[model samples]
Target chain A: MRTVEAMLVAEVVARLCEEANFVLEENIHSAFQRGFEEEISPYGKEVFAQLLSNAAIAAKNRLPICQDTGIVVVFIDLGQDVQVTGGSLYGAITEGVRDAYQRGYLRKSVVNDPIERTNTKDNTPPVIHCRIVDGDRIKISLMPKSAGSENMSTAKMVNPSKGWEVIKEFVVDTVERAGPNPCPPLVVGVGIGGTLEKAALISKEALFRPVGHRHPEEIKAHMEDELLDAVNKLGIGPMGRGGRITVLDVHIETYPTHMASMAVAVNLLCCAARYKTAEI
Target chain B: MVIKRVNTPLTDEVVQTLAAGDHVALSGKIYTVSDAAHKKLVQYLGYGRKLPVDLSNQVIYYAVATPTPPGRILGSAGPTTAERMDDYTPALLGQGVKGVIAKGYRKAEVLQAMRHHRAVYFGATCGIATLLSMYIKKVRLAAYPQLGAEAIYEYTAVDLPLVVNNDIHGGDLQREGRIAYAITQGN
Candidate 1:
């Protein structure tokens, strides 16, 4: 059995927080570079350039790419065979997050309440989602979700009669209505066919996929492609100033759903898709 | 390049000279605050109490800064979304606040305040917190230390680059820039 200690876990979490906050993942960086070349509009291209420069400056300077450093979200794949030998996992994660936020100089954007807002300093107590996987390795994916794009995320329950056309329309309309608000040249993550909450979960999970990768399943892959094509057609462009590359990518992750209904969730990622992963 | 360090309650001469797309750096004294601090500041003012810091001729950057490790002057600090502060901006502007720096778009009312007050709203590049931190030469809290990142800290910067988004003469670079780029792109 693999044993994880509190101090070690805290250290891991701290590093994860710093990397996630400061650096743009290599895949995302490549995607932006590719987008710059593929973008037809001069405006679109310029926006892409600025974005790329911004990412580089952020990483080199070790600062957040956006003011909304985002809510710290951790997806932990813990091995069932592994044992945590040190302090509490939750406590360690929080402590690590605190240390990283302070030491790394990342913003502490988390608030205590949604309505009657109060801040929880240090961006502590990350939204931790742990899944016990089959192997001995523990994989941790840290995502800092900004509110601009996150606010536009939507989930809905569709009747069984509504077919793929409805799904396409719903997804397209969501992107169109979102316009430049989600910071165009966005990544659309779609979660189809699951219970309400599960669908939402899968939608966020889909965002973890590296840009340009498609679903392994043929049908879903085709659907994602179609969605991507349709979203770009909206011409939202970069920064909503209008352009051809409204969407940089579309990712879909699905789960089995109840016979009575199909639930769909759309999670939008702005151009600055910042995330990092680590294993221990 | 000439660098200017001026206090806020900005005058027409300062704001009129600024244009969108000009790469200018800010210096001198500025304060860091975000939504949480905004709320607290509003509340304090609502009760007819003096603010912990004076607003005259001062610029406020909408930011939630991470705390510095031991002995550091400050931590990674960057601008937050401007739209969130639309409500408080007018009030702050009315109270002799001169400049606001943030990322994202702002509403018309906020622009109107800038127009009326001869103030300028500057848009800093988002996600450039790391690069931006190098500009901060000094940092000290003015108020609300309990608010952590939301606390108001006086940041004396040198060449903190930003674009003038909304200026005193009702010029809004974001809207104009977006429109021009959209038309040029034919989208």
Candidate 2:
């Protein structure tokens, strides 16, 4: 078994936290440029311009892309043969998030409890999803999940027979209702299939897919294209003030699930679309 | 779009003149308040206690800025979702808060309160935090320093870009914009 030091994981997570907040993924910028070119509304074009400018300022000045630096969500692809040594893996990840928020001067937006809603202070206890995967190296994908866009997300189960049409309507409805809340133009990440929880997880995972990149499978990729076209047609535009380019892109991930269940989730990522992946 | 340059304290007369869909370049002292601070303020009001800051004719932004590093005017400061504070907003408006800044739809009750109170809702483009921070000419803690980022901070913003999402006359830019741009299936 390959032994990896826990402290290294912490350090990597810390770096990912800072970079993801400070940087907008290249594809996200490309989408913004694309949106700027195609957006019909004069105001919509302006929104895209502001977002692109915002990304530059955050990177050059080392400020977070958005004031809501958000709760960090880390997806860990842990190799089955690897052993984490020197400390608890969870603790190391927490330490990394804590350091990034403090040392990097990023906002600490996590609250310890939902109802009580007291600030956790350091933004520790990030929602880390670990999956045992092939290879000896651990891969970490980080997204500082903003509550503004996150609160606009939704998951639902529909009858398997009537799923396709229902899901399309559901997805469109969500974006319409979300409106200026999530800050369009948005990159919509969708997960279809699996149980409810699985759908939600993969939906978020789908967001890490570079904006505008298609799923590997031809059929699934086609679904993404179809959904993207439909969502953009909503005319929600940038900042939902209305125009073309309501969504920058739509990405979908699918998983096999119980025969009886047809669970779907939609996670709307704002134009900021901050995501970073590193392997260690 | 017609751009309106305005400064606070926004009075009833100034707010009444503004309308939805107007682009605004706002400057002057804007206070930050969100989530926890809203609860505290409303709770304080409930107890008939004098609030820490008088709300009359003030522009309050519904956002908590990130901690500022040395030599910067302010940290990344952007608006949060406006809907989350819908419950607390009527109270603030009742207390005479004149201008509100945030993104997203507001509750009907809050809209009614804005009309009754002669206030306006401005949307600072969500996720454009860095760009917005550039408008912060100065910032200082006003109250609830213990709430950290959620603490109320008095900010002097210059040429702060915003859209008049809701005006005291009950015009809603979001709704109007959507209606104008939403193409029906036949179209």
Candidate 3:
């Protein structure tokens, strides 16, 4: 069995947090470039240009791409053969988030309570999801989710008989309702065929997929393409100023579900599309 | 398509002349507030308490920026969603708040208040906080220090780019833009 120190986990999480905030991933950068070229509205084009420059400024200066440095969402794939030493795994991850937000000059957006809201100050207790995997290596990914887009996410369970057409319509409707609030050109993640909560969780996980990549299954890939086309046709455009390219990409993930249920969830990631991954 | 230059403490005449879809480069002093601060302001107004800062004729930007890094006047600062502030905005407009800078569409009540008060709503491009911060020359926390980033701060902004989304003349850019570009079902 391999032993990984809890402090090392903290260090990795801290570094990932800072890096994700400061840099716009390559896929998202390329998507922005495409949006700038394809956008028909002059106003939309101008917004895209500003977004491109914003990404550059954030990267060069090591500043956050957006002031909402976001609530930390960490996904961990832990090796079954590895053991964590020195401290509890959960505590180490939280420590990492605290250190990164404070030391990196990132914003602390966490509230102590949903109601009677108070700042958590350190940005601690990240929403962490973990899975046990086969290998001896641990993979950690950080997705800094901003509330603007996160607030736009939605989930609904449909009758299994309603099928893919209804699912597509639901996805499109969610984007239409979101309009400019989530900040287009958005990365839409759809999770299908699972329990209610699982669908929501997988929808968020699907956002980590590289932009423009499709589901491996032929039918699901087609659905993603169709959904993308319909969403852009809504003309929400970049910043919802109206133009071509409201959505950069649509990703869908699925799991087995009860025969009576057809659960679907949509998670919208804004143009910032901030996420990063590291393995050790 | 015209880009107009505007200054703070927007006058009724200036706001009345502005129309939706006009690009603007706003300069001069502006106030910043977000969700928590808005709630507090409404509560203060309800209790008939004097506010910490004067709102008459002042422009407010909906922002809760990151902590300022060393040697910087401000951190990545950009517009937040305006919809969340809808409930408190009408009351603030009644207090003579002349203009608001934020992103996204507002509720009918907010538009009504703006039309009634002859105020205007401008939308800064969302997700471009770092770029937007370049225009802010200075920032001073003006009230509610306990709210942290949600504190009401006075900011001096220069050439801050924004688009007029709602104007006093009853024009709405969001609806117009969508109608102009949305593909018809048959097509």
Please provide, for model 3 over B1-187, each residue's C-alpha lDDT reduced to its tens digit, 9 standing for 90 to 100: 5789999879988898889999999999999988989999999999999889899999999999999899898999999999999999999998899999998878998799888998899999988999999999988989999987889999999999999998988898888888778887998
Candidates in descending TM-score order: 3, 2, 1
What is the docking quality class of candidate 1? Answer: acceptable
lDDT string for model 2 (B68-108, tens) is: 88888788999988888998988898888999999888888
lDDT of 2 at A229: 79
Worst 10 residues of 1 chain B by lDDT: B178-187
> Ranking under lDDT, best-scoring first?
3, 2, 1
Considering DockQ, where higher is better, how would the candidates rank from best to worst? Answer: 3, 2, 1
Interface RMSD of each: 4.1, 1.1, 0.8
Query: lDDT per model, in order?
Result: 0.77, 0.87, 0.92
Candidates 1 and 3 compared: the better one by lDDT is 3
TM-score of each: 0.82, 0.97, 0.98
DockQ of every predicted complex:
0.27, 0.75, 0.81
Better model by lDDT: candidate 1 vs candidate 2: 2
Question: Compared with the true structure, what per-residue lDDT tens digits does model 1 show for residues B1-187?
Answer: 3434444446667777876544567878899877878888888888998888888768899887655645667666666667888888877876778788886667777788777887787876554555577789998878998876677888988878776667676666655554444332244
Candidate 3's residue-wise lDDT over A209-274, tens digit each? 999899999989999999999998898888988877889999999999999999999999998889
